[model samples]
Target: MGRILAIDYGTKRTGIAVTDELQIIASGLATVPTAELMDFLKDYTQKEKVERIVVGEPKRHSNEASESEKYIQVFLKALEKQLPDIPVERVDERFTSKMAFQTMIDSGLKKKQRRNKALIDEISATIILQSYLSRG
Candidate 1:
Protein backbone atom coordinates (compact mmCIF):
# COMPACT_ATOMS: atom_id res chain seq x y z
CA MET A 1 0.00 0.00 0.00
CA GLY A 2 1.11 3.56 -0.58
CA ARG A 3 1.55 6.30 1.96
CA ILE A 4 -0.90 9.00 2.93
CA LEU A 5 0.49 12.52 2.75
CA ALA A 6 -0.59 15.71 4.45
CA ILE A 7 0.07 19.35 3.60
CA ASP A 8 -0.22 22.34 5.87
CA TYR A 9 -0.24 25.27 3.50
CA GLY A 10 0.88 28.77 4.33
CA THR A 11 1.38 31.92 2.31
CA LYS A 12 5.16 31.74 2.38
CA ARG A 13 5.91 28.18 3.33
CA THR A 14 4.16 24.83 3.56
CA GLY A 15 4.67 22.00 6.00
CA ILE A 16 4.56 18.44 4.78
CA ALA A 17 3.93 15.11 6.52
CA VAL A 18 3.67 11.53 5.39
CA THR A 19 2.61 8.20 6.78
CA ASP A 20 4.56 5.03 6.30
CA GLU A 21 3.61 2.57 3.61
CA LEU A 22 1.66 0.71 6.23
CA GLN A 23 -0.18 3.94 6.99
CA ILE A 24 0.44 3.30 10.66
CA ILE A 25 2.30 6.40 11.71
CA ALA A 26 2.57 10.02 10.63
CA SER A 27 5.76 12.03 10.60
CA GLY A 28 6.78 15.51 9.56
CA LEU A 29 8.53 15.48 6.21
CA ALA A 30 9.64 19.04 5.40
CA THR A 31 8.95 22.73 5.30
CA VAL A 32 9.25 24.00 1.78
CA PRO A 33 8.83 27.46 0.33
CA THR A 34 5.31 27.85 -1.02
CA ALA A 35 6.56 28.70 -4.49
CA GLU A 36 8.49 25.42 -4.63
CA LEU A 37 5.66 23.21 -3.42
CA MET A 38 4.64 21.75 -6.76
CA ASP A 39 8.19 21.04 -7.79
CA PHE A 40 8.93 19.38 -4.51
CA LEU A 41 5.78 17.26 -4.66
CA LYS A 42 6.44 16.29 -8.25
CA ASP A 43 9.93 15.14 -7.38
CA TYR A 44 8.86 13.34 -4.23
CA THR A 45 5.92 11.58 -5.86
CA GLN A 46 8.28 10.26 -8.47
CA LYS A 47 10.06 8.41 -5.69
CA GLU A 48 7.26 7.73 -3.19
CA LYS A 49 3.88 6.26 -3.92
CA VAL A 50 1.33 8.52 -2.28
CA GLU A 51 -2.15 7.03 -2.07
CA ARG A 52 -3.92 10.20 -0.94
CA ILE A 53 -3.39 13.75 0.27
CA VAL A 54 -4.87 15.48 3.28
CA VAL A 55 -4.79 19.25 3.40
CA GLY A 56 -5.24 21.29 6.50
CA GLU A 57 -8.33 23.44 6.13
CA PRO A 58 -7.86 26.59 8.10
CA LYS A 59 -11.07 27.77 9.75
CA ARG A 60 -12.00 30.21 12.49
CA HIS A 61 -13.95 29.22 15.58
CA SER A 62 -17.00 30.79 13.97
CA ASN A 63 -16.72 28.24 11.09
CA GLU A 64 -15.56 30.73 8.48
CA ALA A 65 -12.73 29.98 6.12
CA SER A 66 -9.60 31.77 7.18
CA GLU A 67 -7.84 34.20 4.91
CA SER A 68 -5.25 31.58 4.04
CA GLU A 69 -7.87 29.41 2.28
CA LYS A 70 -7.55 31.68 -0.75
CA TYR A 71 -4.03 30.46 -1.32
CA ILE A 72 -4.99 26.89 -0.41
CA GLN A 73 -7.82 26.87 -2.93
CA VAL A 74 -5.45 27.94 -5.65
CA PHE A 75 -3.02 25.25 -4.65
CA LEU A 76 -5.77 22.66 -4.50
CA LYS A 77 -6.79 23.45 -8.05
CA ALA A 78 -3.23 22.91 -9.20
CA LEU A 79 -2.95 19.75 -7.15
CA GLU A 80 -6.14 18.35 -8.63
CA LYS A 81 -4.88 19.10 -12.09
CA GLN A 82 -1.44 17.62 -11.47
CA LEU A 83 -2.43 14.57 -9.47
CA PRO A 84 -5.73 13.74 -11.06
CA ASP A 85 -6.31 10.33 -9.53
CA ILE A 86 -5.21 11.00 -6.03
CA PRO A 87 -8.05 11.98 -3.74
CA VAL A 88 -7.70 15.09 -1.62
CA GLU A 89 -9.26 15.41 1.82
CA ARG A 90 -9.62 18.34 4.17
CA VAL A 91 -9.43 18.40 7.94
CA ASP A 92 -10.30 21.29 10.19
CA GLU A 93 -7.15 23.02 11.39
CA ARG A 94 -8.61 25.27 14.03
CA PHE A 95 -6.27 24.71 16.96
CA THR A 96 -3.32 23.08 15.26
CA SER A 97 -0.97 26.02 15.78
CA LYS A 98 -1.77 26.31 19.45
CA MET A 99 -1.65 22.55 19.85
CA ALA A 100 1.71 22.44 18.14
CA PHE A 101 3.08 25.05 20.52
CA GLN A 102 1.80 23.14 23.50
CA THR A 103 3.25 19.94 22.09
CA MET A 104 6.66 21.63 21.77
CA ILE A 105 6.54 22.69 25.38
CA ASP A 106 5.33 19.27 26.49
CA SER A 107 8.17 17.67 24.60
CA GLY A 108 10.64 19.91 26.43
CA LEU A 109 12.08 21.68 23.43
CA LYS A 110 14.38 24.58 24.23
CA LYS A 111 13.20 28.15 23.85
CA LYS A 112 15.26 28.69 20.73
CA GLN A 113 13.95 25.59 19.04
CA ARG A 114 10.45 26.37 20.14
CA ARG A 115 10.68 29.73 18.42
CA ASN A 116 11.35 28.16 15.05
CA LYS A 117 8.38 28.79 12.78
CA ALA A 118 9.40 26.07 10.36
CA LEU A 119 9.40 23.53 13.16
CA ILE A 120 6.02 24.75 14.27
CA ASP A 121 4.73 24.36 10.75
CA GLU A 122 6.09 20.87 10.51
CA ILE A 123 4.56 19.92 13.83
CA SER A 124 1.29 21.46 12.81
CA ALA A 125 1.24 19.32 9.70
CA THR A 126 1.95 16.27 11.76
CA ILE A 127 -0.89 17.21 14.06
CA ILE A 128 -3.21 17.56 11.10
CA LEU A 129 -2.20 14.14 9.84
CA GLN A 130 -2.56 12.60 13.25
CA SER A 131 -6.03 13.99 13.60
CA TYR A 132 -6.95 12.40 10.31
CA LEU A 133 -5.45 9.12 11.33
CA SER A 134 -7.35 9.16 14.57
CA ARG A 135 -10.63 9.07 12.72
CA GLY A 136 -9.99 5.48 11.92
Candidate 2:
Protein backbone atom coordinates (compact mmCIF):
# COMPACT_ATOMS: atom_id res chain seq x y z
CA MET A 1 0.00 0.00 0.00
CA GLY A 2 1.13 3.53 -0.70
CA ARG A 3 1.73 6.04 2.06
CA ILE A 4 -0.74 8.72 3.11
CA LEU A 5 0.46 12.29 3.58
CA ALA A 6 -1.08 14.91 5.85
CA ILE A 7 -0.51 18.66 5.66
CA ASP A 8 -1.14 21.24 8.35
CA TYR A 9 -1.52 24.20 6.08
CA GLY A 10 -0.73 27.64 7.37
CA THR A 11 -0.08 31.02 5.85
CA LYS A 12 3.54 31.19 6.89
CA ARG A 13 4.53 27.54 7.23
CA THR A 14 3.13 24.19 6.29
CA GLY A 15 3.71 21.14 8.43
CA ILE A 16 3.91 17.69 6.89
CA ALA A 17 3.31 14.18 8.20
CA VAL A 18 3.15 10.77 6.60
CA THR A 19 1.81 7.34 7.44
CA ASP A 20 3.70 4.10 6.91
CA GLU A 21 2.81 1.82 4.01
CA LEU A 22 0.46 -0.06 6.32
CA GLN A 23 -1.10 3.25 7.47
CA ILE A 24 -0.60 2.30 11.07
CA ILE A 25 1.33 5.23 12.47
CA ALA A 26 1.82 8.84 11.58
CA SER A 27 5.19 10.56 11.77
CA GLY A 28 6.20 14.14 11.41
CA LEU A 29 7.93 14.66 8.10
CA ALA A 30 8.88 18.35 7.80
CA THR A 31 7.87 21.96 8.14
CA VAL A 32 8.29 24.06 5.03
CA PRO A 33 7.48 27.54 3.90
CA THR A 34 3.97 27.84 2.53
CA ALA A 35 5.21 29.38 -0.69
CA GLU A 36 7.30 26.31 -1.44
CA LEU A 37 4.69 23.74 -0.36
CA MET A 38 3.52 22.77 -3.83
CA ASP A 39 7.00 22.26 -5.17
CA PHE A 40 7.93 20.36 -2.05
CA LEU A 41 4.92 18.08 -2.44
CA LYS A 42 5.74 17.55 -6.08
CA ASP A 43 9.24 16.43 -5.16
CA TYR A 44 7.93 14.31 -2.30
CA THR A 45 5.41 12.54 -4.54
CA GLN A 46 8.18 11.76 -6.99
CA LYS A 47 10.33 10.26 -4.25
CA GLU A 48 7.55 8.58 -2.23
CA LYS A 49 4.56 6.60 -3.32
CA VAL A 50 1.99 8.91 -1.73
CA GLU A 51 -1.54 7.72 -2.42
CA ARG A 52 -3.57 10.35 -0.57
CA ILE A 53 -3.19 13.86 0.79
CA VAL A 54 -5.01 15.11 3.89
CA VAL A 55 -4.99 18.76 4.87
CA GLY A 56 -5.93 20.17 8.25
CA GLU A 57 -9.05 22.29 8.14
CA PRO A 58 -9.11 25.25 10.48
CA LYS A 59 -12.39 26.08 12.20
CA ARG A 60 -13.57 28.24 15.03
CA HIS A 61 -15.29 27.00 18.19
CA SER A 62 -18.64 27.58 16.54
CA ASN A 63 -17.67 25.23 13.71
CA GLU A 64 -17.32 28.13 11.32
CA ALA A 65 -14.38 28.22 8.99
CA SER A 66 -11.46 30.30 10.14
CA GLU A 67 -9.76 32.99 8.08
CA SER A 68 -7.07 30.52 7.18
CA GLU A 69 -9.72 28.55 5.31
CA LYS A 70 -9.41 30.95 2.40
CA TYR A 71 -5.74 30.23 2.02
CA ILE A 72 -6.26 26.52 2.51
CA GLN A 73 -8.89 26.55 -0.21
CA VAL A 74 -6.39 28.12 -2.57
CA PHE A 75 -3.81 25.58 -1.58
CA LEU A 76 -6.28 22.78 -2.17
CA LYS A 77 -7.05 24.14 -5.59
CA ALA A 78 -3.39 24.20 -6.46
CA LEU A 79 -2.87 20.73 -5.06
CA GLU A 80 -5.78 19.37 -7.07
CA LYS A 81 -4.40 20.97 -10.20
CA GLN A 82 -0.96 19.59 -9.61
CA LEU A 83 -1.91 16.11 -8.43
CA PRO A 84 -5.04 15.47 -10.35
CA ASP A 85 -4.98 11.74 -9.76
CA ILE A 86 -4.55 11.86 -6.00
CA PRO A 87 -7.40 12.54 -3.59
CA VAL A 88 -7.01 15.48 -1.21
CA GLU A 89 -9.08 15.43 1.98
CA ARG A 90 -9.50 17.91 4.81
CA VAL A 91 -9.74 17.01 8.48
CA ASP A 92 -10.80 19.37 11.25
CA GLU A 93 -7.83 20.83 13.12
CA ARG A 94 -9.53 22.88 15.80
CA PHE A 95 -7.13 22.24 18.70
CA THR A 96 -4.17 20.45 17.23
CA SER A 97 -1.82 23.31 17.96
CA LYS A 98 -2.95 23.66 21.55
CA MET A 99 -2.69 19.90 22.00
CA ALA A 100 0.78 19.87 20.53
CA PHE A 101 1.85 22.58 22.96
CA GLN A 102 0.46 20.61 25.86
CA THR A 103 2.28 17.53 24.60
CA MET A 104 5.56 19.45 24.55
CA ILE A 105 4.96 20.62 28.12
CA ASP A 106 4.13 17.09 29.22
CA SER A 107 7.26 15.78 27.53
CA GLY A 108 9.39 18.30 29.49
CA LEU A 109 10.74 20.04 26.46
CA LYS A 110 12.83 23.11 27.13
CA LYS A 111 11.21 26.50 26.75
CA LYS A 112 13.47 27.28 23.81
CA GLN A 113 12.47 24.11 21.98
CA ARG A 114 8.81 24.63 22.73
CA ARG A 115 9.06 28.14 21.38
CA ASN A 116 10.22 26.82 18.05
CA LYS A 117 7.15 27.20 15.88
CA ALA A 118 8.46 24.79 13.29
CA LEU A 119 8.63 22.02 15.83
CA ILE A 120 5.10 22.76 16.98
CA ASP A 121 3.93 22.75 13.41
CA GLU A 122 5.42 19.35 12.77
CA ILE A 123 3.87 17.94 15.91
CA SER A 124 0.52 19.41 15.02
CA ALA A 125 0.71 17.79 11.63
CA THR A 126 1.48 14.47 13.24
CA ILE A 127 -1.52 14.85 15.53
CA ILE A 128 -3.75 15.71 12.60
CA LEU A 129 -2.61 12.64 10.68
CA GLN A 130 -3.03 10.42 13.69
CA SER A 131 -6.56 11.71 14.20
CA TYR A 132 -7.36 10.87 10.60
CA LEU A 133 -5.91 7.42 11.00
CA SER A 134 -7.94 6.82 14.12
CA ARG A 135 -11.12 7.71 12.29
CA GLY A 136 -10.47 4.88 9.87
- Give the TM-score of each candidate: 0.98, 0.98
Could you report the Cα RMSD, in angstroms, for every candidate shown? 0.7, 0.6
The Cα RMSD of model 2 versus the native structure comes to 0.6
Candidate 2 segments exceeding 4 Å error: none
User: Which sections of candidate 1 miss by over 4 Å?
Assistant: none
Candidates in order have lDDT scores of 0.94, 0.94
